[model samples]
Target: MCGIVGYLGKHDTKAILLDGLKELEYRGYDSAGIAVLQAEEFSYFKAVGKLANLEAKTADFTTSGFAAGIGHTRWATHGKPTEINAHPHLGDASYVVHNGIIENYQELKNALISEGAHFLSQTDTEVIVHLFESLLNGGLKPFDAFRETVSRLKGAYAILLVTKQMPETIFFAKHGSPMIVGVNESDEKFFGSSDAALIGKCHRVIYLEDGQLGFVSRTGIHLEDAHAAAVVPHFASLPESKLSAQKEGFRFFMEKEIYEQSEVLSDTLIGRLAEDAILFDELNPSLLEGINEIKLCACGTSYHAALASSYLFERLGKIRTSVEIASELRYKEPLLCTDTLFVVISQSGETADTLETLKMAKAAGLKTLVVCNVDNSSMVREADAAILTRAGIEKGVASTKAFATQMAVLWMFSLYVAQTKDTIDAETLRKQIGLLREVPAVVRVHDDLHERIRRLSKRYLHGHGFFFIGRDIFFPLALEGALKLKEISYLHAEGYPSGEMKHGPIALADPELFTIALMPKNLLYDKTKSNVEELSARDATICAISDVPFEKADDFIPIAAHDHYMLEFFETMVVLQLLSMEIAIRLGNDVDMPRNLAKSVTVE
Candidate 1:
């Protein structure tokens, strides 16, 4: 993933572009670049590191009298993180910055080379700008040339181009990646990879849909489809203060997001729960009645959430359920059941693999439901029905609030389906719904363990590797915990079912190894405890996160037991998140912007 920002207005173009790039640095930080047009000439500056390096190199450019500019923060998909591979790549007559991968870049590059075009950078974005220059040289109008170039392109991209030929205007397009147009009170036009980049600079924003091309000038912004059909733009207001708030006393965004899980979970379940029932008016029970099975698809953290949902859907809804990783599902010849309902889950809603899978599911004649946080994401627009998680802007690369909110939504939906099928009586449903409301209160107690978790992190941070063990629904939580640790802390961690430990993972256990055992005292507690004993016998350090203390564990985190599955799940998740955050902090790593990672995976 990468971040793109541009401006077409009277303000200092350099200041606006640089500030926008810094705001979006969380999306990516490997490399940064900016291109500005002053007196109809392009001035470029780039650096290979954090945004601070770019800032250090562009001190004079910020004061230059530029009319329009574009900037980028790259995560390095096509090439190594070097200044040459940084964005704002040059063509014969223009500069372009891009987000998302260009799948057919090699073929396009060969075609351009045959046409006598020279490339300066090892990036797919360079091929695109050169193509634009070739079309302009072929005697096409600027708008028509952009349209044709996009038509020939394949794979995901959100591109922003500013040509010397059209010195006062900025042209842009999106296929699978996200792009937004923002207009301030002064009618200044701003472009960004996400709305977060436009905050404080512009409030009124328009989300650019896939397969759309547009241009912004001092006069106004105009949009059209790939076929040149005119498209009307719809704008929504985003409050700057709410989105751009300062981290109040928190060391990092990950820590704040981990603590925000409770409030976000409450917000996610707000209107959907009642005294004795859960309501999802968007989900037609009649459709669920007709479908014999359910198939859930997602990627990364969302995939773990989907795995957790499959257990809930089968046990509570009394339906056969299967889970698939979106990336793998797209390439395989999956058995498409006409009677199976497909549910796609994503936090950004623009996950490329998941979106492609959603399209495939729709084409196969299966009814689809999407669970997403962003309201108008491509997945939400294409699905038959959608459930919004309402988890606000998650800036941390490792998701915390978003994942918990997704679990809350999944649990609510599962119970709703079960109630509709009469599998769960009214009284049982009421008790579950009541326990859901108390999750926020129970989660608050996790802060008491912060000091203890920090101590455990100090003890285990130097271990060779870590293993996370749980069973049933907890197995998915185990995977999520390991993912969080590996993403931020850069630790070598693996998650496995407790029963499977003896099969293969047990061999990796030694005194240098660290293991986090989730023995939640649930139905499978005894089975999981047996695995923990095996690890203890091997002298591997064990940190048991449970409702009750275990004498054999090297460290113990005690959470009060709950009969309801959701409450116990939420409590354990909070503690595990704290552990990861503390470990990453202790290791002196960038907790918010992890290495070779981005907040959203727009590229496959």
Candidate 2:
């Protein structure tokens, strides 16, 4: 994934573009660049590292004279993170910045070379500009050249192009990666990879849909289909404070987001339950009639959310459900039908694999429902229905509050669906909903565990392996806990069902190993406690997370002893996420932007 920003307005182009790039740097930070059009020429500057380096290099320039420009912060998929692969790929006649992959770039490069076109960088994006230049040389307009060039390319992309011939306007299109057009009170137009990039500058935005093209200028904004048919724009107000993108006072975005769980969970559950203490009204009976099967698709932490949903649906709703990784589901070509309802989960609805899976499921005639944190994402627009998680903006590469909030929404979705199908009685649903309302307060009790988790991290940094064991709904939390440790700390971690530990995972236990057991108080609590004893007997250092302390465990991180159906689900996750962040910090790692990982996966 990469970050892109384009502005056609009265402000200083370079200053505005750089500010936008800094706000969007969570998307990518391997390299940065900017291009501004003044008169009939494009002036460019680029660097091989963070945006700060590029800004230092261009500090002496006069960008106030230029009225239009585009900037990029690259993550480098097709090429290495070097100066040569940086964005703002320039041609003789135009400059282009792109996010996503070009699958047929090699073939296009070969054809362009045969046709006497020169190449400068080892990037698939360079081929795009070269192909556009070739079309312009054949006497095509800038808009027509972009359309023709895109018709010949294959794969996912959201690109912004600026031409010397059309210096007053910027052209952009989207197929996979996210792009949005914003209009300010001053009537200026702005475009960027995400709404956060243009928040304070422009409050009203039109999020681009797949296969849609747009032309933006200082005076107005226009959108069109791939074949040039006119289309309308949908505008939405920006969040209350543009400071949502700022870290405020925290050491890192991850830390700030970890503490935001209480407010976000409260917001997500607000206006959802009625005064009669029932679930929301949006999940009507018509949506659940004869829905025989559900396929949950997601990636990374969102995949863990789907697993949690599977457990809830089976236990409460008695429905047959299958959880699939979104990337694998697209290639496996699984069985899908009109009777199947596909539930796609993603923190950022622009996740490439999840979006692709949703497109394929829709094409197969299955009704799709999106569970996401962002309001106007591509998946929300394309899905038959959407349940928004009010977690606000999650800037961390490793998700904290978003993952917890996603589970909250999924739990509510399961309860709503069960009520709609008449599988669960009204009294049971009301009890569960009441418990859901208390989750935020329950999670707040674990806030004091931060220092304790940091102390626990020191013991596990040099340890060889980590084992997380849980029973019932806590199994998903165990898996997610292990994943976070492994993803950032580079430690070997495994999550297994407590009963399954005897099968194979027990062989690696030793005194140097750390075992995190999620012992939430449920029907399976006693069985999970026995599993902890098994690990302790093998000389494994035990860190037990539960409502009550166990004498056999080495350490106990106590949570609120709530017997609500979903309260333990949310509390255990809070402790796990805080533990992972502490472990990462102990290893001297960047908790917000992990190495080699972007906040959004916009490429396959």
Candidate 3:
């Protein structure tokens, strides 16, 4: 994943571009660069590693006046994170900054090389700028060259191009990636991959549809449809906030987001739930009418959420359900029936594989829904309906609140379906609703709980490997817990259905094997306890979470007893998040931005 920002504004162009790139830092990158068309001449600076390095390298660079500019923060995909592989690659007549992969770059590059074009960096993006120049050299006009260059690209990209000849203009295109264009009261223009970079900088913003392309000049913004027809764009008013990303006195963004889970859940649940009724103003009941079965697809944390929701849909709605990883789903010969409801979950809603799967489902005539956090994402615009998680700006590369809110929304959705199907009696429905009402309270971490986790985290910092084991719905909870630990702590971890541990994985269980058991007293507690006893018999160090005391637990964090599993799920999620964060902190790892992980995976 990468970030792209472009501007033609009255304010210092350097400041605006750098500000936008900083706002997109949460997306993750290893190298950064910016190119400016100032005083009718192009100048650029490139640096590997953080934006700070780029800032330091360009400290004495001039920015008093500028015609146009583009910037990029790159997460290396095609080459090493060297200055030579950074963005803002220049061609004979163009300067370009790009995000997303260019699949057929080698073929394009070979053709360019054969034409006496000089090559430098080992990046796929450099092929784009070369192709633009190549097209221009063959007698194409500026816009023609732009469109022609884009037509040949075989993969995803949101490209911003500035021609030395047309220094007064900024040309752009998007396909299978995100791009937002905006303008100020002064007629100054801005472009970003997300609203976070464009907020407060522009009065209004237009989220470009895939294949939307055009230019911005002194007169105004222009538009071109995917089919090359001129059209007018619909713009939305920008919200009033600087959209700052601070720790809020917490050690890291992950810690702040972990503690904010209570309020995050509150925002997601507001006006959407009652004692015995579920309300989704954005959804029409008619859309749920012909759903004969359910199939859920997602990747990473969202996949875990979908896996958990499948259990709910099957148990409560009496519907047969299946869960698949979105990447695999796209390649397989999937049985996407018209009567089957297809659902996808993503935090950014721009996850490349999930979005591709959505497209496949749409083409197959399957009714689709997206459970996502961003209201202005591609999936929201493309899916039949969406349940916005409203968790608000999770800056951590490893998700916390996003996962929690997703589970919350899916739980209510499952209940709503059960009610419509008459699968549950009044008492069971009321109990489910009441359990949801208790979620916000249970996820709030008390001082006692945090301290207990912090003290016990030291014991876990040196484990050879970890087993997060549970059964039933807790199986997915175990997956999430293990994923969190592996993501932040950089430790080898696996989640298994407690019984499955005895199959082959239990052979690895030893004194150095740390087992975090989800022994919630609400669902199948006795069976889970039996599983933990087996692990204990093998001399694996055990950490049990439940109200009841565990005879074999080396450490214990007592969760409040509940009849419904969701309540315990909420409580156990908090403990798992805290445990992972504390262990990462003890190891001196960066909890907010984990190594080799981007917050939003916008590229495949």
Candidate 4:
């Protein structure tokens, strides 16, 4: 993933671009660049490392009359992360910054070379600007050249371009990646790869649909679809709440997001509960009543959320449920029937593999439901029904609030299915709902526990490996915890069911190995503790995350006990997330951006 920001306005264009890039650096950090246009003058600056590097390069650059510009922070999908490979690639009379991959670049580059166009950098993005310049030289109009250039490309890309020919205009288009256009009261325009980059600058924004193009000038704006047909733009209001972007006194975004879980959980369940029943009116009871099986498909952290929901669907709804990673499911082509209900979960809702799988399920005539955080994401638009997690914006590459909100949404869906099928009694449902209401208060971290987890992080930061083990629904939590740690802390970690510890993972246990045990106060707690003891005997340092203290554990972090399994799952996840954050911070790692990772996975 990469970050892109462009502006067509009367302002300090360089300062605006830098500020926007700072807001969006969480999406990428490998390289940063900016190109600005003022009157007849053009300037470009680039760097190979963090946004700060580019800031230092542009420190003395003035933006007095600059009114148009584009900037990018790249995650390095294609060339090496060097200044030469950085974005804002310049052509004959234009410069461009891009996100997503240009799949057909080699073909286009060869043709451009044949046409006497010389290359400057080893990047697919350079081909785009050169192609545009060549087309304009061939007497094609600006819009026609852009449309033709897009027709020859074959992959996800969101690009912002500016040319000397169109000095006051900014051109932006996207195929599979996310883009938004924000307009202020002055008719000035802002565009970015995500809403986060435009949030504070403009209150009204338009989310660009796939295969759409827009051109912004001081005069007005123009939008068109893939076929070049003129289109009307719809704008939506954005949340200006300071909490959306500020650290709120926290040292890192991972820490602030971890603490935001309390509010995220409450927001997820807001209007979905009745006095004694869970409400999911989106699902037709008559349709789901006859469904015999449910399929949950997702990728990365969302896959773990689906794995945890598999247990809830089976136990509560009395339905046979299966969980499959989206990347693996397309090749498997598992059997499906009309009675099969397919559910896809994603935080960005634009995950390429998951969206592909969702399309395949729809083609097979199976009714589909999607649980996603972004409202108008491609997955939500294509599904038959949708459950919005309402997790707001998660900037951390290692997700925290999104996972918890997904769990909350899935739990409510399970209860709805059970009630619709008459598999659970009303009294039991009421009790569970009551306990869920108390989850927000229970998930808030205590001062003592926070400091204790912080202290425990230093011990394991230097460990050779880590193993996370849990039983029942907690098994998925174990996998998710391991993923968070490995992603942010750069440590090798694995998760396995407690009963499976002796099978293979136990053989890797040693003094330098660190083990995190998820022992929720459920019926499986005793068996999980027994697994921890087995690790202890091997000289492995055991850290137990549970409701009660574990005497055999080398370090213990207690989660508040909850009578219901769903609430227990919620609090257990919060503990592991905190531990992951603390360990990454202690290692002096970039907890938010992590190495070789992007906030959104928009390509295969």
- TM-scores of the models, in the order given: 0.97, 0.96, 0.98, 0.96
Model 2 stretches with alpha carbons more than 4 Å out:
275-277, 445-447
lDDT value, residue 121 of candidate 4? 86
C-alpha lDDT values of all predictions: 0.87, 0.85, 0.89, 0.87
Model 4 agreement with the true structure over 62-181: per-residue lDDT tens digits: 887647899999888778999988999999789988887898999999999999999988898999999999999999988688788877788888988898888998888988788889
lDDT of 2 by residue, 1-604 (tens): 7999998877798888999998888899999999999777778999987788999989997766547789999998988999878989988978999999999999999999999999888999999999999999999988889889888888988999999878888988888888988888787778889877887887788888888887887567778877788988888887547776667897788888888889889998998876334455555556666688888999999998899789988877778889999899989868887888899999989999999999999999888899999888989988988888889988988888889889888888887778767788778887787788787887673435777777866767877888988887778788999988887777889878898888878888898888999887764888888888888999998989888888878878877778763677777887888888888888898787777888888988
Q: In candidate 4, how many Å is residue 249 off? A: 0.5
Q: Write the per-residue lDDT of candidate 3 for residues 156-196, one digit (tens) a residue.
A: 99999999767889999998888999988888999998888
- Candidate number achieving the greatest lDDT relative to the actual structure: 3
Off by over 4 Å in 3: none
Worst 10 residues of 1 by lDDT: 239-248
Better of 1 and 2 by TM-score: 1
> Which candidate should be chosen as best, given TM-score against the real structure?
3
Clashing pairs in 4: none
The lDDT of model 3 is 0.89
User: How high a TM-score does candidate 2 get?
Assistant: 0.96
